[model samples]
Target: MTERILKPGSTLGVLGGGQLGMMFTEAARRMGYGVAVWDPDADAPAHRIATHSFIAPFSDVNVRDRFARIADAVTLEWENVPAELCEWLERGCPMRPSGAVLRVIQDRIEQKQFLSSRHLSVPAFSIVESALQLRSAVDRLGLPAVCKTARSGYDGKGQWVLRDASDVKQVEHILRTANAGRRWILEQFVEYVRELSVLVVRGGNGAQCVYPVVENRHERGILRETLVPASIPLDVAETATEISKQVVTALQGVGVFCVELFQTTNGSLLINEIAPRPHNSGHYTLNVCTVSQFEQQVRATCGLPLGETRLLSPAVMVNLIGEEVQAVTSGEGLYALHATAGAVLHLYGKRIMRPGRKMGHVTFTASQVETATETARQFIARIRRSS
Candidate 1:
């Protein structure tokens, strides 16, 4: 495809005004591009940062038309945007990553099928459209498997892990309550030694760049921290890089693709899931890389040259969830963290907090990866303590 660059001073349309959209707006603005954001929430983070914000749902045709008419090119910050809405936008203006990618990713079964079709390794999974299928899947996958809704699951929601014999009834009950009459997938839980993610950016011209593999830690199925230059064998990291490139290429993906992987104890890697936007794992790049994932997303989607992803320092990123926010504000921990020499704090400016909702993150760089990891973990522990 010929490159049709959306130059600086051009308006870039962003769908979904979450934190990722907020950061993407900041990046585009810094690069001299104007941004227009569309989200249902009036007070969304990106709405405050964007040059123009439409507080209308993606399904609103008027808003979609206005957004397309204004933006030189459109890019989405989240995948849950209706595929039909994306297709409608494509008729008037360019949409990066394309609606095709969203169609596959918005549903778990489709995503897993896409991966399998591309010869990539994913956990053993079966689509469950009925109770009989669920029972069959459970019997085949055995105990300790997970049942997840096929669509709209994020941050550990819309999923249940079955650990033992008695959990089968609980799974049936939960599925009946929450996912009745909807598609779902039953997957055998993978026992992995490391949970890793790779951020890959692909330009319109098919040029690509990859960030260092990130090691992620999750508590209650939400990301808590990320350690850059994850301590893994050189070969393992190389494998992840190759697999990420393959996934992006197969999707014909443009913009940042966050590919999550599972590294087993025996050193084999399996594709866990994919997020086609700037991800929480890549947040550390903002402080430690030559160019951040957000900046790269702007470049990749706007037809600019992809930037260098070289790491400038070993860093650790700790997420600030709602509970942590309360702990920090109620104690001296926030002040102490602010005073820390190497720590960089980033708050999302969220007005309300839920138990596991991501409110912000802190990145700290150290001479060594171990030091960075320990410092980030310790700081989080300190901040989570009460006064």
Candidate 2:
């Protein structure tokens, strides 16, 4: 079947209204497409700029029906959005990535199993339905393993690292007191050399474009910075790229996807996780790439031709977490950041800020990677001192 191409002026529906959705909405609007954002939070950033907005729970059948009636094509900014909702939307129009894809990627156990079954390299993991299962899995995977909820966790939430017997006992007790039938995953810990990620955009026609591999640094499991063109051997980069493309193609996914990987001490790569939408690490594309991940998402969703993934410059993307946003939004810090050459600041426009919440990001671009890296380091240090 020929894919239906949604032309400009047609309304595009996005399932979540966070920063990713807001950016996708901006990109669609720039390309002459109207955007309808559906997020339960009325204060979600995308809701403010959306041409149409649906502020209702995903379980609300009435809102789902109304959204299905108006949207020409549908995509999502968050994987946690109910797969059933995507399945319902699919009956009306194209749902990029589809509900089936979500069901696989949203659950840690299922995602690991799918990748492992495909012979793709992934961390050793076992499913946990109860504390007893957790202990059994730990006996196999051993200490220092990580335990995470099978669903609905991001940016360090719903996770624990069991480094010793005490940690294991505490986590087991936490699990024991939790709701019945809830699932978790125990993964063998990887002492990786560096964290790396690649963004892949696949179209309905099976054509794909991959952005440059990037190195990521995390602070307490939250992404602190991303360095474009990860400083790895050419062979390693090629392998990472190949693995990411293979994963997305195997899923039959038709949207922007981010594959997180761990480069172990042995120089082999292990799949960490996958995100089915534009990722924080790819934010550098906003300033350095010919087409940002958000724009690629719009194109893939609308069946439009995918854009070029050319890198315009080396860049460092630093996320503004929680109170860090205050340092850059006003006063001398804001002025200093604005004055820095090749630096671009993007604020998410979220109303409330709390610890660990992602508020915005800054992208620093330069002709040389070292220059961008040094400038970003200096800026980060300055902010830390102020905070």
Candidate 3:
């Protein structure tokens, strides 16, 4: 089949201005494509580097039209860019991954139901409104469950883990956690040994590509590290890849799609979440693989074939949140991070250093995942020292 053109010098419009968008802009720039992004934050990471930035609400049709006029095509850094805005813009220009896919993923309830409809196994979950409904859901799903806001939750924010009925009393606090115009979703906790992620890139012509599985680690509910070529059995790893493909076909999605799953002791995999962008888990690909997720995102959105997903060596990626960076109090602490072997530090140009805000990341590759992991861990001590 003949392919469409996504030649160099093409201008791409991105919808959000977070780090993912920043990285995407960097990749596009490297490939000789001009990038433009629309975000409200003047200091947003992506906006800092974009060739053109419209500092306005994504919901504004005029901004969308302006982006359409300036850019050859449209894409987004994250999934929550109000598909309505994309839909409104699509009438003016092409937007990748389709509004259909975005609509299902924008809401957690719809995302979970879409997975279930495709015969994918996800954690036991219930959607609740009132506190009484939450208590009833907990009663059915059991204690020790997690309640996550159905929309606008990410980076371990907007979640509550309840050990028992007493947790129901905190519903008001949970409700207030999300910005207005969102609701909470309750999910039964799964006893899993590890969390894994797979990223798939589908071209405009329906051509597809896949990346290797990555195991993720979390601290205090926030993602802390990701290890490439996960230690799971080969069969399990392949299974994860297959499950990810299932999600891709189910969503009828094009461009990079991320599937987060939990692997149980009984050799089962269950869906955890989905992200239709350059994901945090795929950060290791920047150095470990021949093609990084950011590159793949642009390639797929531009209707090009996917690239290699091979790993040259074991790799680990560490997230540097604002809270963690602020805790680094001295020059010595900052120097330690720069000194780590094989470390590639990517700092988002976000001006705010608020607690729990994702600031940047460090990645390293080695022949040994465990040793690489330990080396990455040593930075925590330095962080503590600086704090």
Candidate 4:
């Protein structure tokens, strides 16, 4: 393939209108690329600064055509966008890290197949399309497994973990109720040491860029904090980097690719899941890396040579889930942190916050790991109290 680029001042189309889209738009604008975004919500953050906004659902043909006509190239913020919709746009304009990437990622069964095809190590999993299939999967995978939907599931949604023998009946019941007996995957659970992620960017020519491995902390399946330069064995990190590259290659991904991984108790690396765009783990890059994940994503998707993904310093990040969201009042525990120097706070101008909703985040660096971890913990404590 020849080197291709979407020059500055070119318009980039973005799908979805959440913070990720907002950040992607901001990155493109900073690089002199005009951004056109499509989202059903008129007030989406990306719309605030986009060159143009096409207000419609993800499946709206008019919105897709408008994006194709306006943007030099197009990409999505999330992976759950319907494959058929993405395929429809491919006839007109580029929608990348490849709509095929989205198609595989949106379904766990396809994702597992993709990974297995690459010879990447993954937990034992079986697809369940019927009650008998579910029973067979249970028999094979055994007790203490997870049943997850093949599509449109995130933040721990559309998933159930089975630990007890009786939980098998409960999983079948839940799947029947939820999907009307649609297909799902039953995966063996891992008693892992920790979760980690790597964000890789591959340009049109396969020029790959990688961010520092991030150690992620999760609460109720949502991210809590991400610490860069994750304290792990050097080999563990290297293996993760290698696996990420292989995954990127397998997908023919042409933008940001986030590889969620698990460090097993026995020190082996196993893939957890994948995201075909800028990820929450890479959020720490905004303050700690030379090129933020947002910028790297735009550059990669636009066919520009991706910048270095080097780290500036050891960093810690804490997510703020504040209350008083509806009232716009400061919710719990802001004062608990009272962070001194080098602290960066980013609040998403959300009007209201209920429990578990991400309100904002704080990121900063520390010379010592203990200090950084303590600071991040306190900052989260502050937000916890407010909520």
lDDT of 1 by residue, 46-164 (tens): 99989998998777878777788898888988899888888778788788878988899899999999999989999999898876677889889887898898999888998888898
**All candidates: TM-score:** 0.97, 0.99, 0.94, 0.94
User: By lDDT, who's the top model here?
Assistant: 2
Selected candidate, larger TM-score, 1 vs 3: 1
Candidate 4 structure quality by residue, lDDT tens digits, 1-387: 776678898999888877899899999999999998888888677788889898888777776776787877888898877778777777777777777778888889999998998899998899898766888898888888998888777878888888887888877776667646378989999889989999989887877878888899988878888888889989889999999999998888888989999999998889989999998778888888899989988887787778887788888987766462322233223433343456777666655557777777778678776687887776565445444
TM-score of 1: 0.97
Question: What would you estimate as the lDDT of candidate 1?
Answer: 0.88
Candidate 1 weakest ten by summed lDDT: 325-334
For model 3, how does the per-residue alpha-carbon lDDT over 1-387 read when each residue is reduced to its tens digit? 755767888898888888888999999999999999888888888887899989987767777667889877788888888887777767866687678889998888999998998899999899976555777888888888999888877877778888755676776556646365566789998899999999888777777788888899998777889988788889998889999998998887878899999998787999999888889888888888889989988887666678878788888898887667654334665676666677777778778898777787878777899888777777655564555
Show where candidate 3 strays beyond 4 Å: 1-3, 172-182, 326-330
Q: Which candidate gets the maximum TM-score versus the true structure?
A: 2
For candidate 1, give the lDDT of residue 128.
89
If ranked by lDDT, best first, what sequence of candidates would result?
2, 1, 3, 4
lDDT of 4 at 279: 88
CA lDDT of every candidate: 0.88, 0.95, 0.82, 0.81
